[model samples]
Target chain A: MPGFFKNKVFWSGVMALVATLILINMTSSERENITLLERILRDTYAPLQSRVTEMRDYLSGPRSIFIQKQELSERIAELEEEIARLNLSNQILRENEEEIKRLRSIINFRDNNLDKYELLAARVIARSPNNWFQSIIIDKGSIDGIEKNMPVITSKGLVGRVGSISQHTAQVNLITDREIAVGATLQRSRETSGVVEGMVEGNLLKMINIPYYASVKPNDIVITSGLSEVFPKGIDIGVIYQVTEEPNGLLLSATVVPTVNFSKLEEVMVITDFWPVSEETEAELPALAEE
Target chain B: MCYLIHFLLPFLAVFLQSTVFGFYSIKGTLPDLVLVFVICFSIVNGAGKGTVYGFLCGMLEDLYLGRFIGINAIAKALTGYITGRLQKGFFRENIIVGATAVALGTLLNAAVLLVLSRIAFPSFHIDEQFVQGVLYQFAYNIILAAPLYGWYYRSSRIGLLKLPGEK
Candidate 1:
């Protein structure tokens, strides 16, 4: 009956049921394929949000400029002291460069000897509303060749990888997110391979599956192991803060302090082209080059 | 015009929270203005209308984030419905009633979100900081409720101030 449908309780129950179905469907999906409504809403709001953000920054610039002026005086004093030291170092560096050029010419170095990393720079546009998920939306997406699983990093270190890509934006899962797993190894001893995982509590990474006998200690640098299909090798990950022996005594775990500061992240670079070398391939690289 | 303002206010609040207010977060926990808006809106409107607003606001947020599409929508809608149901039992003109509704509604919304997050991401574990942050948000919502309710009341032409002996 129309009366029954009009009842507040009836409508409330119906809405509840509809919401439950949506939640179930959404959670089960991989979240990459957004619905038409979602896509439209995202496309519509992203530009508005960008404009508003720019306006806010523009408004705040004057106040920041005043503060920077006071700070700049002190910075200038320190820089003046450094200029004399740098002048001497600059001369020494010029002499070293000439010597290196002569040595390189003797070795007959080619232009292709240096491997150039192809990168795309992007600005962070937004952050997740909830603290449960650590992610940011970058202003670049498929239009900028930012595909899913592409490694994103800052000048400091690795941030995360691209998750879902839209036309003009992409979601980057932070390295601190629990869902992310990174292959890492101790820089001092490359044979000591481990897996770096994010903790649920704080912005922290923990390296596990380390050999119990490996001489791992605090302050050991950790780098990408190149074992992952997603990330390439030689990327700086973090440094070990502490080492703990697992109860099994067969493996050890260490807490890592990531080099990238997630809280202050603004701009990042996406690695578009990089080949990860496997252990066997690395061993055979010199032989193959010889032929 | 009223319908457009109703939709625009929440959208603007969400945008500000995501962009500007995000910079002023305390210990990585920012006060959720969207939650405050829903509670205030629900207090002004009835249960049915509040639920609709809640759904719309939550849906917009989910779209912006592009993850867990219906989670926020369902939680906010239920919070709005619950707050709206409280209107008939208490004096709507009372600031205490409005603030109480915001505190309780925000706590409920947070609980529902945490539960849904656990269900979706099984590895998520509640830490002490998370609990503390939720409590801080509850207090923050209460502090924001008074001013927001006054603004909504003035705009709705619902008689802004309750004089002495007003029921």
Candidate 2:
């Protein structure tokens, strides 16, 4: 028995068994907390990581090329002149017409519906190194009312949700992050609730668990479901890129091309005031007395 | 003291790689200086220290990138351990050998990530572009390994810690 125990292979096998048990126990115990911990870690390290990346960029030298070609400069000047001329004409036309009324209506709609959101403008400071994945760092942070879980967007469409916030910087986990899952709906029919998950291959998102009977079609716009209370309702997420029925005939999935080109993100808007519903409102309402 | 340096240096490398050197792409591929640094540290040090450093570096990376929390930790730990074991059989002071090891290590690291990604996400297809990205990164990393090794070697020397066997 002593000689058998003394064999190195026996000890090695024992160690392997212990390790497997430990791993299985850990995985089972921490299954629920893993996502939350991942989020916290992302938030905490994002700023420092961003700062280090900025320093590295500084070390690597300037990124842009200064094209000093005379022809290019002349073409730029001509375009600027044309743009100025168009701006003048447009301004005169706008002044002569009821442009203010149109703007007022739009503002009124936003005020009535999106009153809770206080929008702050920011610039993109950095981007994820991998092209297949999409994420960005913005110059705004907690100091500017930016916070984790805030929704980030551009005029084009939804960009991502804020993952981390430091005093003066925030990290946005773009819609393309594999771990990101957002509740979204089809804008056209508005009949389905689907989970949007990032595809691992490319900068694309896939909506899962759409009811097979829903009237979704190609080119249907997808918007935030507002079920999670993070992103408000009606924020455009993307246009449906493809749709396929599941083999089971119960569920459908679709690929969506995000509206914001994450690679070229320059200016973004961080929503500061997505007012959450009070707990009282969420409480199951007492059954109304029969009318 | 050495453990702290090991932890901090990899963190610093990851930080720089993500923020600053991240944008410096040549033909759409950037050098993974952090991975190279970790591999070098593992080889110069030993398996135990290498595993610790690798895990910490991976944790820091996971924190910043917002990916699966333990994936990097596990990958890096394995990488460091393997590299350290390799170091045991060979001399650690050869720059060319270090560069080749780094190049191979980077390739393996990227491959591990690809396989893990596939396992974690079976719905998506891992394509040629992904493989090309890994190869391009491997080339870029090898190009920069010599300088990175030189820098770390010089710093350790200046600090009066000889190369692993210099004493």
Candidate 3:
């Protein structure tokens, strides 16, 4: 017994085991209510980490000239495409403005009923270790009015929602992670609703519980159903890749190709002020002041 | 100053992993610098200190980027302990020994993470991509092991911490 206690191997093994258990317990606990120690640790160290990142970027800047050149070329091409898009958008908006005037006179619908949202632009400061692309640490946090469940987006489409926050940083759980699910609808029909879940295989998104008879097709656009409180309705989620029938035959699922490139995600906009309108509130909105 | 450097090293490694390393990857696999740090440190520090360093490094990793808590810590601590035990009979300065330790450590780290995530969370599942990623990352870690070992060797020889074999 004394010999066992004296064994260094035994002690090391015991410590490792204990540490493992403690780590698991801490992670599995409810994430919203982070422990005070963890909060303090994150708040205290986040700034230093952010500073170190900036310093590393500054130091590495001179050595990365080739990458910068390649990026500049790509940015030029993207800008050209953007210009074409803006021209098309101008034409569409002119048509929509005329139609909207006619419709507004007839319907008496209020424009302010649309949820007002504030966008906070954040930089991608850090990432998870494994290249799992599950989550990323953004430079925005509670101090920036970023809160848990706020949807993070790129101009292209949905990225993820804010999960945990420190004083100066927040973790954006990517839409590709298994833990996240978005209520989505097929844009072509707009009648079918389903849940888009992150799949482990190929890091793809899967839309589940779609009705078996829904006429979902390849390349059909998917957007937020606004069924959940986390995200507002009509945000672009992804495009359907392939629709498949389940073994049970009651429901259908589709493979979704996420619109946002998780790998190239750098700058994202956080929706800060959007409040989801419940069915009951939406019903009663007409009785209130029109403004 | 030395203690602060020791504390900052893992955080810096993770910070870099999250930011700079995200841009640079080979075949969709990135090197785990913190794991490299643990393996190299264990080889220099021996099993007892290695275990402690591994645990601390892993915890920081979990706090920074891990999806689940403690998975990296458990994997890294075990790897550190095992590599530290290897330090006794093997030449710590040898490149092959250090690189081999890193290879084993990366695989162990991945295996422990996968197995534990499976056990702890019913929602988590494994696939071919995960397996391929683990293998790619293992090779990547091995490729990085030599330079990291060289750096660790040079740092330890600066007479900061007592060398493993030095009396």
Top candidate on lDDT is: 3
Per-candidate local distance difference test = 0.76, 0.68, 0.79
- Selected candidate, larger TM-score, 2 vs 3: 3
Chain B TM-score for the candidates in order: 0.89, 0.85, 0.89
The candidate with the higher DockQ, 2 or 3, is 3
The estimated TM-scores of all candidates read 0.78, 0.66, 0.82
User: Which structure is stronger by DockQ: 1 or 3?
Assistant: 3
Off by over 4 Å in 2: A1-116, A126-135, A186-193, A210-220, A244-251, A276-291, B1-8, B25-31, B62-71, B88-96, B107-140, B146-166
Please list all clashing residue pairs in model 1, or write none if there are none.
none
Question: Can you write out model 2's per-residue Cα lDDT over B58-153, one digit (the tens) per residue?
Answer: 656655554454456666766887887888777666788788888878877876766655655565466554666677787888888887776666
Q: Write the per-residue lDDT of candidate 2 for residues A1-291, one digit (tens) a residue.
A: 589788886686467435533443344221322345544544555667556545655655654345557868898999999999989998897685556557645544222244346889987766664443457778787777777788888888788888756566677888877667888999888889998877653556889899989888889999988776677777888889899998998999998988776555667998887775444544422221111
lDDT of 1: 0.76
lDDT by residue (B1-167, candidate 1, tens digit) is 56677778777777777666666565656677787888877887778878878877887777666666777887888898888888887877778888899989988998888787787777667766568778777776788788888777666653532222323
| Stretches of candidate 3 exceeding 4 Å from the true structure | A1-23, A40-86, A93-115, A201-203, A245-250, A279-291, B1-5, B86-88, B157-166
Report how far residue A189 has shifted in candidate 2, in Å: 5.0
- RMSD of every prediction: 5.8, 7.2, 4.5
Stretches off by above 4 angstroms in model 1 are A1-32, A56-61, A64-115, A189-192, A199-202, A206-218, A241-255, A275-291, B157-167
TM-score, ranked from best to worst: 3, 1, 2
Could you list the iRMS of every candidate?
2.6, 5.7, 3.1
